[model samples]
Target: MSVETMTLQEMKFYTGTNPRPEDYEAYWELALVEVASSKTTMEIVPSNLQFSGVQCSELIFSGTDGARIHAKYLRPVTKGKVPVVFLFHGYSGNSGDWCEKLAWIQQGFAVVAMDCRGQAGMSEDKGGVKGTTYSGHIVRGLLDCPNKLLFRQIFLDTAMLVKTVAELTEIDSYRMSVCGGSQGGALALVCAALSPAIKRAVVQYPFLSDYKRIWDLDCRGSAYEELNYFFRSFDPRHEKEEEFFSRLGYIDIQFLMPRVQADILWGIGLRDEACPASSQFAAYNRLCAHKKMVIYPDFGHEVLPGFMDEGMLFLSGVKDS
Candidate 1:
């Protein structure tokens, strides 16, 4: 079946909610403009990883000062520049865990999933970037120095994964895409906007955008909890607040949303308290290229109700896949 475009009103009706005030949309637009104007430095280098043949193989990428980021790549039997999908993991999840979710043998796409720094429960995998976190890692020190946010390094690590995958002999450099759920979802949006190599994006239950709204709502997960703590501890007044959020503007979905030129498929749950529907819509509405959002009213946080068919259909049209 061909992908169908749905209007924002239809989305609200189907999902059973009214449109938020226009001011919310304005906030997203303003933040995005600043993010587009700011410059971020990214560096990529080759490294190694270990994966089990069934679904995973280890790969690594180097960040600033040779900090290594770990990754797992799953390749189909087909050879010669196959379409590629770079998968990013959510908060506290690892690369090995996403191998099954992103495996592409069935769809003829090459999949590479990367582990974010500092997450636990990893097996004897080598060369993965070590993440640093302690009690209250997420919100710890966020209010004072947004520049030192963990996501900054995570974004850099994700970019390095893309660059490494592009160099692999069996993957197509030009036809690559990035995808993930929640944290991964946010990263996918950033990669599509920042990297010229990305041609498609699949974001599911995305987190990290509409930061102020999310902070007010009090969502679950470290991403939100961290912000809550940061605000409680560090007090930013006027311009300081803007500078803190402005640094975040570099990675915020709204800021990155407009720069992304690829086709985008977004999955959202109306009842999703974790990421919230409004925040997800804020990002989807600002997308400049062809885009579609699949809303599941009865579902929250998980993609369901024809999501399987939709994913297949969306990826099928990606010329290289």
Candidate 2:
């Protein structure tokens, strides 16, 4: 049966058809080592949206290649070090305004939301890659060496953000969670996989998984739209499809998830078109850590009702698994 028509029961056991690069593990290990060598410097700018009980600041730090990455840092006016939740935004979005983060702070959790580079945020993108002309991030640097992929750099930024947050005087490095929806959800899982410090990941309908499956299923719209554009404009005949997908496998979340040691609170909207539930299952099923799945059978790519509330309660004890 075609994946599009598969029942939810069938999706539970469906691993995608994406070709994982043989050296996926080694690629990330080497990439992690490369980022570890890069020096990270940070500056805290006073935030204009501060409130009486919460400390809000704009944080800028160096990501891979000295890109100036930006993040919003907020913490409750608490007496001791508090658990923290690292936040990532959706594709083409920024680290949202400070007012929205107050709820986490009010819950006694420190929050750090990073603005992804070259999207709708303050982070910098230092370009030095081949084939950089793509409609969206998925295929940016498609012709470059595996290390030059944009998501590779973004994934590295997630690790760097974790390292930076771990150093804050008011944060309990031993207790940290990561949270997001869509692209944010993917990066949360990416951060959890790459950074050993993360304790729990609250992933909501994650994107960037099982590209081959997405294509075959014709889910070439929304975030996956770029994949369709890349083929029609570049390869045109699926002649080099294997090569492209293998390269993409390096940054694919399913390949990286095995390294994740965090407790996972993964949510899926069964009707999700942008990121098909089968594509998400490709990554989720590989996780060996403590995990819980919250499914919204009637919803699409939109927010999962009550999922965030459930995740917040789950991240309270951010001790790394």
Candidate 3:
């Protein structure tokens, strides 16, 4: 079959080219401690959008560096605690409409969809990095310490969401799950890795993996266009290419896959140009936990057929009869 990336056979073995920082594990450990120490305050205000058998609220909470994160929370009005699902959005996108999240709520699962900080959402991003925030989030803290990497704080935001939700009286923390595509997909994996409470994760064609490989393929548009912008703006001569990509490794999802304990459901499209199949496999290959991958030979970065239904089934933990 014709391929936009590596051949399917090569993809399975692709371990990624992004250099993992030497203190990767330690860096995240300290970040988690910061998240733990933050004085997080949550405010859930009732939303005007009302649906039968479901209660909706606008959730706001403080994240690392005092960023006010926003999410739409929806729960079934039932008495007992129920499963919760965390939903993330694609690059430069928000949590999305309330209607799209109702499916999970209808399935007896409470849903929290996060609007990434400083994106096309209500989440506040207190930008104080040393370099440019002009093009992309990946390059935000490149000129400064790795701890200032935007994704580091974003990943912690997701973990803080999990921790907060787990503490909710109406949530069955043990049954928690997360799902998303592209940038959101990467965050889903990060959330699962950071929070042991996540029982399942569904990610599709995740971005932010195998960065050097993406540069090799020259497929850095769309979600990864920021990589091009960063280099051109900051390191036009490619003099510090290795240094920049290596710093990005600190946020690379492939390096964090091993820490994820949840059963993962990954969808990969072989023809994907936005997020190459090999890049997705780079992270998938490292997962040691129970996992399943659904391959789409002809599909690109677009939706995989029946994946939504499949994901719902996975999150619901119910087999189709």
Tens digit of lDDT per residue, candidate 2, span 1-321? 223556778777877778988888888889899778877689999897779898889999988778888899998888889999999999988888788988898789999999888888878878643222333788988898887898999999999988887888899999898999999999999999999889888889898999998988898777788988899999999999999998888878988788889989888888888888898998998887888888887888886778887787778753322
For candidate 1, the per-residue lDDT at 252 reads 61
Ranking of all candidate structures by their lDDT, best first: 3, 2, 1
Task: After superposing candidate 1 on the true structure, give the runs of residues whose Cα lies further than 4 Å from its correct spot.
Answer: 1-56, 98-103, 121-147, 218-223, 236-247, 318-321
lDDT of each: 0.61, 0.85, 0.87
lDDT (Cα, tens digit) per residue for candidate 1, span 22-82: 3434543553444444333323333243243323455655653355566666666554668
Highest-lDDT candidate: 3
TM-score of each: 0.73, 0.94, 0.95
Deviation in angstroms for 212 in model 3?
Answer: 0.6
lDDT of 3 by residue, 1-321 (tens): 333556778877879888988998999899888878877689999999989888999998888677778899999999999999999999888888899988898799999999888788888888832222334787888899898888888999999888777888999988999999999999999999999889899999898888898888887677678889888898899999888888999999999999999999888888888888888999999998899899988898898999879989988988431
Candidate 1 minimal-lDDT segment of 10 residues? 13-22
Model 1: lDDT to the true structure = 0.61
Q: Rank the candidates by TM-score, best first.
A: 3, 2, 1
Off by over 4 Å in 2: 1-3, 128-135, 317-321
Give the per-residue Cα lDDT of candidate 2 at 34. Answer: 71
Candidate 3 TM-score to native: 0.95
